[model samples]
Target: MITLLQNGAYLLNNSEIIEANNEAEAILKSKGVVETKEEAKQNTMAYNILKEHNTSGNMEKLEIKFDKITSHDITFVGIIQTARASGMEKFPLPYVLTNCHNSLCAVGGTINEDDHMFGLTAAQKYGGVYVPLHQAVIHQFAREMLATCGGMILGSDSHTRYGSLGTMAIGEGGGELAKQLLNQTYDVNMPGIVAVYMEGTPSYGVGPQDVALAIIGAVFNNGYVKNKVMEFVGPGIKNLSAEFRIGVDVMTTETTCLSSIWKTDEKIKEFYDIHGRIGDYKEIAPGACSYYDGVIKVDLGAIKPMIAMPFHPSNAYPIADVKANLKDYLHECEERAKVSFGDKIEYSLMDKIIDGNLYVEQGIIAGCAGGTFENICDAADILKKSDGIGSDKFTLSIYPSSTPVQMELIKNGVYATLMEKGAVMKTAFCGPCFGAGDTPSNNAFSIRHVTRNFPNREGSKVQNGQIASVALMDAKSVAATAANKGFLAGADEMEGVDFTKPKYYFDKSIYETRVFDSKGVADSSAELVFGPNIKDWPSMTALTDDLMLKVVSEIHDPVTTTDELIPSGETSSYRSNPLGLAEFTLSRRDPEYVGRAKDVYAMEVERREGKAPAGELADAYDKVKKQFPDADAVNTALGSTIYAVKPGDGSAREQAASCQKVLGAWANIAQEYATKRYRSNMINWGMIPFLYEKENLPFELNDYIYIPGIRKAIEEKADKIKAYVVGDAMTEFEISIGELTDDERKIILAGCLINYNNTSK
Candidate 1:
């Protein structure tokens, strides 16, 4: 069973629970460590082993000098554009741009491939590396080349986790990476570190997702590990393989943690060696007397197969629990669908959970978490040992994490085994995980081993009256579900199956030959190629003395994900072009959101040039002037839309916030932010993260809200804020912005991270 520790606990000595707590406290006291109540305060470890290695100051402020960094096509274009605007002349560090996400450019049009060409030219001009489309997915390529023990890496994607191999990897918005490219430091208050102590070996049925979901459910809402670094340590490290550990590591983002790391050993060394990077391996472990702010002890022996229901990852339950209480669980899933799917479409999970049995229409094992070799091989073994149950009603698809893993599986006859059992294997692609590949029929129920099961993540386009649902499960359960002809089944029930673990063989020739490498050489003479679809960001105006925003949409969904705002799949190709992408903002959530925003945008554009706004916008401006009694006392700014109420949750996709900016959204007023990365995305895009404290709202959509002296408030770094809604009552609300660093305030004041960087340049 997994348990939360009230205090730190010692593990190495196998001491009694009481003695373990005492030993932990004693170790801390002996090393001159003290605890504080400050949320963001820095606490040194019980011992100073880092000082012996580097003789450096406290790790709170660090100078990270990395050999290289990497991002993919969907993300690199934005990062590079930001960096270039920030005075980046060349790639100071080796930056590899991989193009696996937008590989199938021909789907929508040839324009997506043109963006790839642009990326290739940028790599050549900027002295960077470029992996052509289909070479490999971003994380797999990085695992093979970039990770090093004790080294820190950052990515723009939320799933950017490599802790299983000892790298303290963080997934932030594009702005953070742009800062690095411009040779700037990542600034944040030193975060707390949590020890995830594990013991006991997991049974054959329990997989990484099972363990990860359990931890996520415990720590997500409680903020147990929020913004802290999770350091995995214990004998459990030896019981699992590198891939299994990686599956758990990637889900750390769901805990709202800043980053993650694990003690490295021969398993990590073997991982590096297989990827032909023996030199990159460095043994890393926590000191024997290391201290943590909090501790979570997980006994793998008790972990059962888990599934994260609808809406959020935190809505998790064990398979056995769901089976025993199918009616309640299914009802909960339906209620969640109402908020997640909205009124745009009708969806029900009760049909899938018929006769007290959960029946899924589709099963997928893909993406960073489930696409590993061990996951695929285990699934293959289960399928091979079972009868060839061919049913058209149930479909299964698998995508290996990388080309190398695919090659290894093929060589070991696992591919043939899966194919015989009617499982179709695809290439290394992230589309299935984020709503692009293998889209299901309307109202279809799917079980996936992917990272997320957020609504509309299955490429359903619910706003168009099409809908599909997915449940997050491990590879073992997915395979078992497929074996049972789409009936949801746990892995433990299947006996007499030996999951043969095979040695992984890495092949690097595919990447070495296909990918373009500049080897850290800058070429000033090279010219960047721009596609027709590629467009520059529109000029953003500074915050006016007073601001007026018409709330185009106000959502009551407890959480709004990036997928709902901008969607994935066909719309993903527009990410490189800000204005082009803006057209898809809220396309899935509100089919008319883009048009409504544009209508408001036109008026704002007219007003910016000192022209009278048209339609109701002009009338609203006149009404505001009547109250002020001085037409010129406050300046007016224009924007097409402003989304209000609790929003900005899930995914580090900057496009979630950026698309709104591109669509002429002045700001987003919310009760609070869901993730640090999403809030950072808004700041980077020059959108105000207006906080509203009132539990009940006094404003409606399409109503103008004015916040006077906003520019002055930002300059003075004011905490409490007041805004008035334009109505007969002139409703007012109290809101406050939480603590912000000097740099953060400046970035918001300057309109965007890019503009701030440009001014510095």
Candidate 2:
């Protein structure tokens, strides 16, 4: 059971939680507290680490300088290109670029390999580190090689979390990485700290995913810990191994939190020891009278094996409950489909029911979360002990996160066991986690241990009337389902299962032989290689005095993910080319979005070239001028916009916002943004992230809206922006942009990051 302490709490010598109703009074009355408030504040594991990294003089706002930054192939090319445009000579900090997301070069011909070559060349030229394809996934590599206690890391991937290893790691968009390459600080207001007090050991057959899913389900929808730092502390942490703790830590990204850190013990020290970096270990714990803005009591003993059903990681339920109420739960998914997909396609989960038992067509244990050494060993044991895994209409696959994990599995004979049971063994690739590989047949249902199961994340193009449902479970549960030949079953359903812990041996020779590390030495004379597919970013104009936006694609879904905004699988190969990747923008969610946005883009091009607009666009521009005398064609900048209830739900890929900006999109209207990284991406890419109520009746698709004096309003930090409907009366609504850093304001004013940097120089 997870309980919320909403009114804040104080940890008394790490023994009991005292509600901080009156801060001074509560501290004085508790005998467990030995330190003063200021002393306690500096004692937390997060506080010391944050203070060491913060460049800002005050703690109320932070300007953090991370020790290291990491990114995968899909993101590195764009980040390096941006930093290059910003006049960077060499990487000031150690940057590790791994090629895992685009390892599957099957779809895009030579473009995937082209990016890899560019990465290697850039590493040599700019003093960066590059890991070859299939060597290791991004997060796993960081954990095995780059993590250190009391040190902070920043990555361009959303799952860049290493707090379980006592490292404070944050996942952000490429813009943040670019800034770091230019020696800029990550600026943010001091975030609220949430204390997670865990106790009791979890029951057998329960994995870290179970505890994580429970915590996520409890706090995700309510925004209880949104953008806050979660500091885990308690005796129950002693019950978990380093692997188990890491598993839970990585999934914290699903809770929409900014970052996470855990209390360190011998287990974390042993983890660093195992990786041959014992000196990196440091003791991290909260002070005797440490205070927290909120508390989450996680009784690990009460958490059951969980499964998050289709469409989202937060649509979770216990495995036992799911089995008992299959039909009712399946109907709920169908109802969600009616709203998410509407009449675009037929999406059904009830049809998979067979003879009072629910079935899944595919089972995958892949990517950083499920591909760990311990999780795979347990899954292999479960698969080997089962009576039989019938191979009819059911398939299972496993992708180890790294070559080292694969070597250990092979040495321990676990690899042979899984392969003998009709499970396909694959290499270290992040494809299965983000829709590049293991794509199910149309309308088929699959269960996976991957990180996310958002719509179209399974590689199905919903625009082509193809759909596949994915439910998230632990590797153990996924193995049980495979053992039962696609029938849904919990790991505890079977008896006498042997889940013996295996010893993991670290092998550094694999990476040392194949990977390229410049060791802070750059060859300035090395020529940078770029393939034909790698194109430079187009020139962007500065923001004008007035703005005209045509509502291109309006989506009323509860949340729109990055995968839908700019797909991951095949389109990732084109990330180095901005205009090339922009073609796929909103391709899955809205099929005609590119064409509609491009029509407006063409109109903007004509206006900039001193040519009069023609066709329907010209008529719309004239109508806007006629309706709102406050707007004139000479001062107005034409662009496109999309309205969604909530957008930017998953992935830290900047392409979500860059794709829109490249397509001449000026703004996105939404009730709220899904994550801070997404909103920051939009702002960095020079697209206005406008917050509006979902119930508004102001704009429709293809309707033109004109905002007068937008440039002046932005410069003055106006709270509300007035807009007018092109052919009708003025429909002004109050909209807001919460806060903008000086750099962010400049980026928007200059149109894009590339332009801002160039204009500043």
Candidate 3:
């Protein structure tokens, strides 16, 4: 269904692809495109967008100022507090605060709504926009209001992609948004551009989720498009509807791509026009001779009804194949669960298999990936054609992306059709997508159209001995399975079913009547509201000359996600309070992580207060002093670190790194970072992102590692630093850090973005 190009490719007039080789240059030259690969690279849509937003003169390294920025309730409070700490007078650009993630207010008593009020007052005080609870999800509101042709938007959520609308939006950590609020630029190296060249139309039952799953399965593990911009350019663009393209675009985050954009056509223009923003419509396309670092060729027609099994979005398989080999797939899921959950919980998919068929307990169609107008309408049609969704363990829930979409569905009768078939229709809250709503029974299997199916994403706490699993499928397939009373069934299996394919009518009044828009005008007299649970960030000290770091937690997971670092769902209510939220750090992944990190943090606290280090810390300092006599307790900052095989694969939540910083972590030693956003978050939080490539390490859990002249090494831009594992004797090894810009190095020295901004002023 999807093929990744083995080498760089050239697109001639955005129609023909020529693989980069000796003959490719001649083919391009014959087409009257004699430009070199370097010159042609500038013709990509991503290159042009980056060039437009880049404040720096050079393209090799970019300093970008986004046109707008956005955040949800779970993230905005922390971002605003960081900016407030950094002396931000007003928002430097347009900002939208949406209360979708924490709208339920079902967890952490009064904390969720308290965050909503804080966001409202912050918007008023700082000059921004605020969307009330249940009005719209973060990405949906951005798509309807903020997305502009050829513009850029930055959000604090990882799925912040709006490429189908001709906008190059990026989802980053709150630190990056805080920088924008402080009139600072987002710095990074220019990303590679990959063309998603499509050629065929999707089959009858295959939806956007199927196409996205196929692409994700092809490229996610292979790193074919990791940290690169995916620019959709092909004849197949015209075959898909506007919303279908959007559904696929949002899932690009799962592929580990930096951002995404698509060739804008009349359909996209109509999309803007329908949303009452015709002025924002602008056609964008690749130049006649555009060069891409790589290309993903997608055959939409060949894409089957696919399902991504538990633990990852990349674990995709065709529904037909899975049904044919049910036991084998269930066994594979059991093996994978052992890798993720270990002996912590009793997990089994075998029990979910009733007789000869797999039966799921719940089906959810919600969030940015599933809760779109087209997906829901098609799902409603499928359910309308079926008999009733029987009253049993099986239950189905549907959530529209926004009030506007829900209103349109009401007008079109799609909403009533779904409800009549026993499918519960919810508001525009993002709870189901991130694990705050409709949690299934223990060990129950659920099929969702949500973004992720990682462990505990369904709100089951493994530490509490509660374990459930989620499998990802398209909305249509979920409806079909519901029609069959939760038995596994693909949409393609339902014959003679006609999708209504109703036209969407955008109701702008839904937002105008509820959303608070400041129009970039700030009220300096507005008093900021703070809830009892809301708390300021704890003060962090600057980086010291030498460092002593203890390895607290070591994870061997091939890829560690942000959820494991700091979980979502109920714990998200504590995001506004750094210390309160830090209490839950690694609580799910490693039950003992918090106690270990806090134990090391206490020693650092004692040293900062001019007290002598106690117990093991004192003994380690004496050993270090015996080797390097200049290494004193005053110069060497004691802290903790974690070793992960590959950390930071999902979510752009800064708390993943900030939690470590709050717990007195000074560095993270990993084989390699899974995403650029995670590494950036580490630097922004004043924690070192260390690279240790060798399989065998010089340090183990609770082992102390001393690195002398660490501050000087960063200041001098040293490539390699000698660190000795403090044991019976000093066992030395070399660890290196990735390239950092001058400002990044300064941020590390100043001990985080907040301190750097304050000291810079």
Top lDDT model: 3
Superior by lDDT: candidate 2 or candidate 3 = 3
User: Candidates sorted by lDDT, descending order?
Assistant: 3, 2, 1
Prediction 2 TM-score vs. true: 0.97
lDDT of 1 by residue, 665-684 (tens): 87887887777888878877
Residue 647 local lDDT, model 2: 92
**Candidate 3 structure quality by residue, lDDT tens digits, 639-756:** 9999999999999999999999999999999999999999999999999999999888778999999999999999999999999999768899999998999999999999999889
Predictions in order: lDDT: 0.77, 0.88, 0.92
Off by over 4 Å in 3: none
Q: What stretches of model 1 exceed 4 Å from their correct place?
A: 6-67, 353-356, 613-634, 640-645
Ranking by TM-score: 3, 2, 1
The reply for model 2, stretches above 4 Å from the true place, is: 22-28, 32-42, 613-630
